[model samples]
Every structure is written in C-alpha cells, then in structure tokens.
Target: MSSSRSQSIQGTLPVIAALLGNGFIAVLKFVGFFISGSGAMLSEAIHSFADTANQALLMVGIRRSKKKATNEFSYGYGKERFLWALISACGIFFVGAGATIYQGINALIRPQHADVTYIVFTILAISFVIESGTLIVAYRELRKTGGKAKFKKILKNGDPATIAVLYEDGIAVLGVVVAFVSILLTELTGAYYWDAIGSIVIGLMLGVMAIILINKNRALLLGKAIPEEVKDRIIEILEEDPAIESVTDFRSAIMDVGKYRIKCEVEFNGNALAKEMFARGALREEFEEVRNDYQEFIKFCVDYIDRVPRLVGNHIDKIEKRIQEEYPEVVHIDIELN
Candidate 1:
C-alpha cells in the first residue's frame, strides 16, 4: 500500500482504541460515582466522556481530511482535522474542567459527609485497569512508528498520533493523582469538601492542558512555520553544496497532521549558474534530490538562481586602450580571454 494510506491507517487506529477504551471508562466511573457519591469520581466520569467525544471528533476530522479535493476547495478539507481537534480541546476544557470545578464548588459550599474510602479506592483501582488498557494500545501504536519519542517534545513538535495518546495518558494519570489526594485528605480530616476541591483542581489542570493543545494545534492549522532547528539543518545542507554560496531565507508549514509544505530562497556563486540551468529538467527533479538527501525530515525544496552580469562598458574601455598600443585583430577585434 501507499505510504500515505499506511500513515492514515496508523494514525486512525489509536484514536479508535482511545474512543473505545474511554467509553468503557466513562461508564465505569459514572457507575462508581453514583454508587459511592464521590464527587471526584463523577468529575472523572465526565472527563472520560468528554475525552470519548474528543476522540470521535478526531475520527470525524480524520475522515473529513481524507476526502478528495474538488473545484471549490483546492486544498481540500485536510484542515478540518485542525478544526475538529480544536473542538476536542474545547470539549476537554468545558466538559472535563467545567464539571469538576462545578462539583468542587458545590462541595465547598454545602459540605456533605462523603464515603471517601469507597470512592477513592474504587476509582483508583478501575482507573489503573482502564488507563492501563488504553496506555497499552497507545504504546503499541506508537512503538510501530519507531518507539515513542519524548512524550511532550514529540507532541509539541509534530506527531499528532503520539500527541493524542500522550495527552490522554498524561491527563488520566493526573486525574488519578487528584483523586488520590482528595480522598486521602478527606479520610484524614473528615472534611468532605476536600474531595470536591480535588476534583475541581483536576478539572482545572486538564482544562489548562486542553488550552495548550488547542493553541499548538491552532498554530499548525493556521500554517505555522517549522522549527528553527529544522530550518538551520536545511540551510546547513544547502551550504555544504559547492554550487551554493549562501542561503537567504527558508520557511515551512504543516500542510496536514504530519505532512509539511516547504519553500526556500537561496543565493549561489557565479560559477554555479551554468550547471543549474543545465539541471532544470523540472522542479520535481530538484525536489526529489533534496527529499532523498533529507528523507522524511524534509518534504521538498524549491530553488532559484541568478547569474552576475559582466560589465562590458568598463572592460571595453580598458581593453580598447591596451589593444591600440599592441598588435591585435584591427577590424572589429573579438574580445580575448583575460
């Protein structure tokens, strides 16, 4: 199969797994919350539900992006993935963060005697099982693509699949911690409000993370430039070519989740002009050469060249004076090599 198709399939698989696993967790947490009247458990249930919705949104975005380009939309709907992904982030903020905070506020205002032990233990145990299942699937998905890279660095750099899984796992772990702390506090002091406050804090934390994801994804969707290190790398490669004198500027954008769109401006020495003209079979050939050298790190390169003009006026004056004094072709003397 084609590489693009393989990438698409691989990208979609983890989202599917996340949606399924999150759906199961959502139900479990909701049931656990109701049985034990644990505010944190309820908050987590909503968080899972929101996450499921976000996964669904991601799937929809992915599917939309796969549609063929049409007359009205030349770039097609690939950017829809960004829009949907942003929506998912909003969902995380509103559903996950909002619900948790609301429960926390309620707990603070109207303190209730919570059976902290049951809520904490049940959610903690189930969170481990459910989160472990999802984490395993995520790891399996990521491992195929060359073992998971640095979690946040990859997510921030440009690996959407890894980003999604990392986001989910990271948030789930935080929720567990929040639940554990709140339950412990309540158990120790018998202040039921502490559990509610914990739920709220977890919500806020997830909400902030959601905003960061949204901002990062927003930049990509809006055609943000590539990292400076990548630009420097490209420039370094170009400078190594003897034909190239110097690079003026370079820029790139994320065309899709992982695909990149690149453009560059360069300057070359006078001697390189002839070879460059001879080499211009088509733009794609030049792009292919660069792509081969850089592999997946670089999608392609666009090049332009300029040749310095000889100053005939000044050279002619000097040559005429010297030639008159010496022997040469008297009639329309052809210029000799200097």
Candidate 2:
C-alpha cells in the first residue's frame, strides 16, 4: 500500500478499536452498576458511552478530512479533523465529565449502600484489560509518528485521531482503577461516600484531559505552524542551491493532519543574474550606445526584466522540488524573490 493509505489505516485503527471496546465495556458497566448500585460504576458506564460517541465523531473527522479540494476550499477539508476533535473534546467535558460530577455530588448528599461488590470488581478488571489493549494500539500508532518524543509532546504534535484515542483510553483505564479502589474501600469501611468521591475524581480527570485536547485542536484550527526543526530543514534545502544567496524569510501553516503550506522569500545571487545576462549576449558594455538611446534602452530593459523573472522562477522550482522530496508533508510552496 502507499504511504498515505498506510497512514490512513493506522489513523483509523485506534478509533475503530475504541468504538468497539467502549461499546462492549459500556454495556458491562451498566450491568455492573445495576447489580451493585455503585455510583462509581454508573459514572463509568456514562464515561464509556461518551467515549463510544467520541470515537464515532473522530471517525467522521478522519473521513471528511480526506475529501478532495473544491473551488470554495482550495486547501481541502483537512481542518475538519481539528474541528471535529474540538467538538469531541466538548462532548467529553459536558456529557462525560459534567454528568459524572453531578451524579457524584448527588450520591454524596444521599448515600446508598452498594451490594454485589464482586460483580463490580470483576467488570472493572475486565474493563481495565480492554482499555489497556486499546491504549497499546494507540501508543503503537503514535510511536510510528512520534519517534523519540515524550508522551506529552506526542499528544501535542501527533494526529488528532490517534491523540483522541490515546487520551480516552488512558483516562478510561485510570477511571477503572479509581472505580475499583472506591468500591473496595466502600465495602471494607461501609462508607458509601467513597464511591461518590471516586466518581468525582474520574470526572475531574476527564475534564482536564478534555481541556488539553480542546487546546490542541484549537491551535491546529487556528493554523499552527509546522515544527521549527522542519522549517529549518526546509530553509537549509533552499539555501543549498548556489543560485540562492539567502533565505530571507520562511513561514508555514498546517493545512491538514500531515500536510503544510509553506511560503518563503529568498534573495537570489546577484552574480548569478549578471552571469545569465552575460551568457545571453546582453552585456552592459555592448548596450552602452543603446543605453544612451532612450527608446532602445527601454525596450532592451523590458526584455531583460522579463527574462529575470523566468530565471528566478526556474531556480525557485528547483528549490521547491528539493524541499518536497525531503519533506513530503509540504504540499504547497510559494517562493518569492527578494
């Protein structure tokens, strides 16, 4: 398969896995909640349901982001991924975290004993295993793109689909642990408020994670630039050409998950232009008399000026090709002469 196709598949795998896992786990959590009457279990059930829906939204983003460019959106639908991710973040905060917190506070005010403790423990253990598996899949995909970067850096710079799955699954696993501990503590001490406290903790964790995701997506939607190292590498490539004296300025923006639009201003070698004019038999000395004649000089100057842009354009093309070969993520490039 092509690299893009491979990347697309890799990106989709986490969402699909999360959707399936959360759907199954949500049902188990609901059943466990009904059996044990545990506040933590109920919160977990709601969290799993929210996770399933969030995975669906991510899948939509991934598919829509692949849409072909139209006249109205010449950059294509890449930013749709970030938009949908932001929506998903809000969903987690409101539906998952908000509901959980409210339920926890209500339970704390009116405590209720939880029975069937064994069932809740079993379900949480199973959920933990399943969530761990999903997290492993996300981490593997992240590693493919993240190289040696730390986990927080990966979450910041990685693709939205993978990042969403990683965050959701990681939080899910931690939620399961909290739920398990809360149930165990409540059963041992006969204090039902522990379960409510666990629910509150899980809600707070999800809230923090949602905020992080929201900020990352917002930055991308606002046209975050590619990494500084990447920009520097591109500049290095452009300056490698002898015809380019210096790269005066460089700027880039992320157009999609793995694509960018780069604009650069480069100063061309003055001697190179002089050499070209000499090679074309347009030496200034040859045109000395022509320069004295206003009409002839004007015509000659117009032709020379016309040829300069073409030569500069050809040099820019070479530089663009080199950058593209070095970094396939750069899909659009605009080079201006300085």
Superposed model 1: Cα runs more than 4 Å off: 116-120, 139-152, 237-244, 268-338
Please write out the lDDT profile of model 1 over residues 1-338, one tens digit for every residue: 75467655555877887888888878878877767677777788888888888889988888887787699986566677777888888888888788778988887888767665465577677776777677777766665653366644445564454466557767887787787788778888888877888888888888788888789778877887655655566557556655556767666666565455555555645455445545765456665556657653244422142212343334434544453333121112222222
Best by lDDT: 2
Worst 10 residues of 1 by lDDT: 327-336
All candidates: CA RMSD (Å): 16.4, 3.4
TM-score of each: 0.72, 0.90
In model 1, residue pairs whose N, Cα or C atoms come closer than 3 Å (at least 3 residues apart or on different chains), thus clashing, are none
Query: What lDDT does each candidate get?
Result: 0.68, 0.89
Instruction: Give one digit per residue, the lDDT tens place, for model 2 in 155-175.
Output: 777898789899999999999
